[model samples]
Target: MNLNQYIDHTKLGPTVSLAQIDQLIAEAIKYQFKSVCVSPVWVKYAKEKLASTNVLVCTVVGFPHGTSTTKVKIYETKEAVKDGADEIDMVVHVADVKAQNKKAISKEIKGIVKAAAGRTVKVIIETAYLEKKEITSVSKLAIKAGAHFVKTSTGYAPSGANVTDVKLMKKVVGDAGEIKASGGIRSMEDAKAMIEAGATRLGTSSGVSLMEGEKINGNTTY
Candidate 1:
């Protein structure tokens, strides 16, 4: 498959600068990646910079951690969509899954998805912190909650997306929603492996190097 089409060129570090956002937009446009994912604060700027292009502007809500209240996540989703984010990757509360609180999980996911209006909502289940059964369970809940996609990780976890996780997520989702494999995907081989395991999208801070068919080097902040 054409990998670029599935790549969501991302930079979600806490210390990202406007200059870096400019560089990210430039690289995204140059490489023709599907989208440029950033924090909510940069969504408008990224949207403006890429207004004349087909590249999408994506932003995160309740990022890195999914412990935010449902109300906060809903508000974040609305604000992100208002700020010109074409897609919202909202993290789901990991505690809900660990506690087996399916009702709360469903309620939270629904609230965020509803607040997104018509914008695409990708529910980040933070697979690294979940067991295999939790992965399948949450994937089903995401689909039932009206999420457009079920994402694998936040890239801030101890581990990120793996082929086995992707396969399990896809099996659970089963065309009900798309799967985005993210976090720690830093090479062409890793990207391909995720896609081969049924990832419709790949999120990485190493998009530039991966697109260039190289492994990321140095202490990158993504």
Candidate 2:
């Protein structure tokens, strides 16, 4: 497997610096990663840096916590797209999922999808905070709302992606949407397991290490 193609070479820490983003872009160019997932603030810079390459520029909306109002999330998506983001990874409101407010969840997702204006939008359900049934339900909502992918985590949660969650999401998404397994995936073994479970994309800060076959010990915030 060409693992690099599946990776969205990621770095989304709150305190990330310009130098770190430059390094991230350089590494992405070197490894030919599918994209570089950065914070919204760096979308323009990353896009400019990656203009000549096939690597896309991805950004997050509603982020680690999915409490932002739908209007705010839509504005974030528009601004990120204006700054040249090629893909958007958005967090869904877990409260709505818990409340079983399918209408609200669908509205929020559809709004963001419309704001994205045809760019790929991956909805992050932050599986760490949800029940299995909730995951399945929300993944269906995302697909119904026209999201291109249903993502596992934001990497800021207590835990991240797991094989079981990926498989469950895959079953729900089927061919209507794709799966992006993010967070806690630290090694080649972990990446392969996610893929086998039906993840077409991976959001990780350990892409280079995984490619080098080196497993580093620490928490990865992707």
Candidate 3:
């Protein structure tokens, strides 16, 4: 598949405004990116902006923190979908997963997945906070919970997706669910490495820069 075909050109931050989202949608339209992941508050606007295009509107649930109650996450997921979000990226309950409360973690994921109603739901395990073994176990729970994809991070963590983490996640989920390797993917080389590591999707804000990097420096600048 084309590398750009796997990219979700993301630009989600508190500093982002409606004007910025307009620019983002314009960029997504220009690049023909696979999707545009935005904050939930602007999902409606994003949907409206991209209504005429083929791009999908993706929103985050539980956001950078994955500690929200299941009810709240479900509510958020439902609201996003209602607002025209095509995909929901929900964070996993890190504490529950780390404490070995598999039931609670699975329950949380299942609730959100159910609320998504078979829409593209990607469970963000936030791999930055877990060990390799934890990543594998959590991925299994995410898949078992009926999530369509297992995502790496929220991009607000101290670190982001790594080649090793993607490889581990891929092994756990196998061919059942997609793997979304996000965060810190700033170059085509980095994106390629992750794809080789089994990442079927990439979430990155540096997509333009990565495309720029694809330009060889054989000649002088214009």
Candidate 4:
């Protein structure tokens, strides 16, 4: 497989600068990555920067934490799409899953999906915060609620993507939606593992090193 096509070259740090985004965009263009995942604030800039390129612009909503209210997430999704984000990765409210409120969880995802217009919506289930059953349940709910993808992590959790989790997620999503393995994928081995496990996309900040075949230490990037 073409690994670069599977990568969503990401940089979602709280302190991401224009210079960093420029570098990210440059590398993305050079490597022909699938997309450049950035925070909402940089979506428009990234969009403009890659206007002539095929790299899509992706942005996160209610990132790291899935505690944002549905209304807020919907608004955030709308703004992101308006800002030229081709895809929106929204964190699902894990509290709803813990509370067994599948309705609320589905409702939140539907709201974001609707707000996303025709753009793609990837629901981040934050697997580290949920039980195995909860992961399957949320994955089903996300697909039923119209999400286009079920993502594993946000890279800000206590733990990130694991091959086991990715495999389980693929089992749940099946053909209903694609899976994006994010979080702790830092090496070529890690990347290959996730894809082999059924990941259609990957979210990581180590795209440059990954392309150059370097093994990085930390999975610190988005």
| Residue-wise C-alpha lDDT for candidate 3, range 20-50, written one tens digit per residue | 8888888888888889999999999999989
Write candidate 2's Cα lDDT for 97-213 as tens digits.
Answer: 998999999999999999999999999999999999999999999999999999999988899999999999999999999999999988999999999999999999988998998
Clashing pairs in 1: none
Q: How much is 215 displaced in model 4, in angstroms? A: 0.5
TM-score of each: 0.96, 0.98, 0.94, 0.98
Candidate 4's displacement at residue 116, Å, is 0.7
* TM-score for candidate 2: 0.98
Candidate with the larger TM-score of 1 and 4: 4
Q: Write the per-residue lDDT of candidate 4 for residues 128-217, one digit (tens) a residue.
A: 998999998999989999999999999888988989989999998899899999987878998999999999999999998888878888
Best by lDDT: 2
In candidate 1, what are the lDDT values of residues 22-129, reduced to their tens digit? 998999998889999999999989999999999999999988788778888889889888889999999888988888899998998888888888888899998888
Question: For this target, which candidate reaches the highest TM-score against the unseen true structure?
Answer: 2
True-structure lDDT of candidate 1: 0.88
Model 2 clash pairs are none
Of the pair 1 and 2, which is ahead by TM-score? 2
Candidate 3 achieves a global lDDT of 0.86
lDDT, each prediction:
0.88, 0.94, 0.86, 0.91
